[model samples]
Target: MNPMTIHVKQQKHDLALAPSRVVFYEQMQLVETFDDQSQCHMLFFYKQKYLTAVRTTRLKLHSYVACAFKEGTVYESPHPFLQALIETNIPLQKYSYPQLKKKIARPYSRQEQAKILTFFESFIPKKQLFQDMKSLFYQYRREGNMSAAYRVIRVMRDFAPNNRFVKEMANDLSYRKLANLYLEESQTLMERDPLFKEMCASFEDHQRLLEKEGRWIEAYTHQLSHISNQPTSESYQSYRASLSRHFDSDSRTYILEELSQAIPSFQPVTEDLFHNHVVNENVNAVARLYTERELNLNEEQFKQVEALLEENRFNETPENLLPFMKRITAQHPDQTRKLLDAFVIRLLETMELEQVHDFLKAFKKKSSLMRKVERMNEIHEDLDCMQELGELYYGFHQLEKSIECFQMEMELKPSAPEPLRWLSKVYADKKMLDESKAYQQLCVDVQKWA
Candidate 1:
């Protein structure tokens, strides 16, 4: 079945007037008549007087018709239909007709006033509108008309939810910001209103502004208080998680620095709050904090944090570690080296011996023995460092030292046929015939494999 088309007709003389009828017809046969009573009622209440006759004829009548007509000029007078309109309007407005009339009489409540103000709000210069609203709200506040002020605020909130003006009012008067107001008023609003949460989440900017004004404790306390109240709140949790992930390193460092000042003495519970609840599972901000304050941490506490990070395989990048190294080294050079070595050894211990050896070979400093060996190996014409050392020892007829060098060379490159052959020759020269035969047999075996 095709949906019925609605028709509407409006009176042209009065800008405040509405449609005459919303007609539904099939093939020009009037199947439905939504006459003037219903149509006029809808227009009056919605205050949509700009509607034309043609426009009105296109409307679909709804249950809101009575409520919409309650304030109409002819419709406002007492009649059975008007009484029904009042009754409907009252429940929808949550107030009596007299109260609504009184509200409408006020400058802010006038339909013309609202329309003029709204038009100016849209098309007038923003600064002018902002000033006008600011003055209006303040005047209402001074006159002890909080409702008027609130209405003005609502308009301002619509225009700029995160405006410094709105924030200042919320801060100074403890007026629940629009975001918090929506959240406090309705669970449905909290669930459905993304703008509300976004506005509130922008409090981080407010926090930073407070910090820049050197209100560290105040900023810290405010954020902590806000977070405490909303520990499990999704918006709050997501904000913190995003902060940890997206903030620049310096910003994160600054936040941690402020946090240290804010909570200098670690309460076990507060520490746990940071580790288990606040810090995201992916980013190790808590561990970074622990590392930053390691000097203040006892050995057991340090170990606990370290173990937790290790268990999770938390790898701090060089950018994170370098500053920490600089700081520790500046404080205690000797202790820092020892500490670093201990950590390095621990990391090495977790890997295979060959992997550890390979890591050391790659990482060894230019002056390091392994680096010297590597450089010498890279030169095609050069003997191994061990071979050169062995020759020096052999010049003194130190057979044991020479044998040790040959063994070291063999261990260093087991696949190298030259090292094995040299080892067999050394053993033979030492008059150790059995050792010579064994070394020669190993050389033959390695050659076959090669």
Candidate 2:
């Protein structure tokens, strides 16, 4: 069936204005007639739902037409529809819905506002929607809802795609002194924005000015503020470098003590402070910081820790090795296994066999298992390792590794039932039921042939 369309006409010139006449047409036939623009809006805005309601209630035309044309009532409670209408107006001047006119209007959440903006994009005319969304973007900025304001820019981009202002809102907010607002969208913007270069340029400018005036303590405090605001690796390094250049040992300790007393409630601060401690070779302080948060060591830092461990013959206490091992395990399989091997050897001196088995199970050995499988394949040139390794991976809930191992086994030993059966189970666990059934059939065929 052809969809419905609404036509609205108002008395253009009159001594007294008449109500706007609205007509609904379906398949080129006049389906309904009304004198309310709001009803006309319902047909277009709510679209199919309101149309479905109209079709279902056509038998009671008198009551249905009367109810639909009422001043502030629609299909649902007028709050949401009124909110939608207010959004349609962009700046949301006056309420068309009488109930909302006198009530205190609660501002919609960022999520709700995004939904309304999305709805506007759906049915509103392209030119008008663009203007309305642009107005909304400014409104959000004026209201200090920077996160939602940035999201409005995204919505505008989705609609216009090549809009110059939308592009500028994202790329040029730094020049507009709205970079902090943009950073609230995600702090990774510190790392991503080339202008900021992971450090607030304005903060750096202030620090440089203070230093030139011989206000070293004030300049150093500005550097700390920059770190607190951004907490990026670059900002932290800048802070440390500035501190080292100006402060003697006593002064450095005093300033650091003040920093510890005035720790900001940012998780990134603690993480970066831990890194700073590591760089200064403050071993006891670094150990104490381990209780606060996990360390996010960069490649250089990881290599330093790895070298330190190698110097100690991987015989570091398990508690000390565990943190670095957790973060680097995925990328450093050999080192992780060495750490694990050290842990097992240490635990075996006091721990029972069953206790050791449970402890080993907790640290999933995916990378090590894959490495072992590859080493075995390199040495023996056989498919025997495939089934065992695949099952090991599957037991650890590492479906991707299990799939890789099973596939290699299936290719190398097509007549093997184990790989077929294991692949079926792994795929089923992964929610690929069709592939699971196919593999299950393959497994049955292999078993029958055997």
Candidate 3:
């Protein structure tokens, strides 16, 4: 329905003589009316819930009507809010009294605000108006009264028209509401309700809010969608200028297609962006790419490797893990230490200890890895690596080899309790009770001294 228009000159004049001022924006609905006896009333719903009703003479009706979103309410009042009821001085000549009278739902009395709201409820969106009336209705309806709720529903539903908010709410309320608020109604009718430009602005606002909450993926997805759907506005020119910020646009296309299609006269950015590279998923391919200097590992590419590693059985076939360890260490040794530990621990977690010895034997047979392991300072002195190797030997009944690791651990550092502790266990496993007791006493002594 067409909203009422307030006569700003008359409202400004009224503002001077008023004793109270009530200013509100974000209008939900408005109506001006005259009863059968010509007693005029105006109702205004502001900020989604504030409903102000005022009784007035028909002489100054234009000032009682609604205005633009920034319109204010200035009046003398008993309490905090201004009250007005409107059914006259329609914003446009299209709405006449007889035409409005046909739309009224029921008989109206002199002082019945409830019936009065019902009479012209068809002029407003049913859901929003009902919600407004609900705030008002429940004030009268007490103690979780179903009857009052039902009664209020029945009264408003009979007259409330389908408001845009209620209608678009079925689709998507947030998008529609912001669309209507920012773009002119005619601008939005171009099929994409937000018309691309509006969407860019809204997305930027939404992304900042998402970023404040540390939702990186959600914010990135929004920017990605904005670029994907292909908005042509200069508002998104800065976004088009940097196409790979949120994603691997090199993974998308060599050229920034959105900027390529922009209107040269309107777009702020005149040049198109071109990036080149492939996100290699296979670890071997990635290693080659790094060697050739054709690609680099980012968090996204690293995630791809992790996902690929998750799918493989590192314990069942040492081929994938063994080569992967070799390739990563060769391609990016500095970066692969933590990754290698993760790979080793994952394999050990799933492999039987007895098979680990065979797996390690097969692993060491890879000449490339043998060379890398011999020269690699990465895990050379790592105590965790030695301890894992020692445990693997102990699991397979290689007592002497396990004892060698424990002895190396004692020599690798001063006198760690862990090596002493392991030495005690290995001796006990060998049935040398005297040696075991001696190592255990040394462990206890070390623990106390340290």
- Tell me each candidate's TM-score: 0.27, 0.27, 0.24
Better of 2 and 3 by TM-score: 2
Best by TM-score: 1
Sorting all predicted structures by TM-score, with the top scorer first, yields 1, 2, 3
**Model 2 segments more than 4 A misplaced:** 1-215, 230-238, 247-302, 313-317, 320-327, 349-357, 366-450
Candidate 2, TM-score vs. the true structure? 0.27
Top lDDT: which candidate number?
Answer: 2
CA lDDT, every prediction? 0.44, 0.48, 0.44
- Kindly give the number of clashing pairs for every candidate: 8, 0, 18
List, residue by residue over 220-308, the lDDT tens digit for candidate 1. 33565555444444644443454454344344444434444555553432354444412344224553554555544445544554454
Global Cα lDDT for candidate 2: 0.48
Q: In candidate 3, which residue ranges exceed 4 Å CA deviation?
A: 1-351, 357-450
Pick out the ten consecutive residues of candidate 2 with the lowest summed lDDT: 47-56
lDDT tens digits by residue: candidate 3, 1-450 = 112223212222321112222333212234344434555545444222224444454332122133321353322232112222122222222323334333332332111233334423334433554565556445544656433333343334433435443343323442454445434634444323211223344666666755664444334335545654665566365555444554443322322333333332322222222112223233443333343333345566555555555554243344345654655555556655555645545544555444433444544333433333332224435675776567655654567867987788777755678888898999998999999999899989888989
RMSD of 1: 23.0
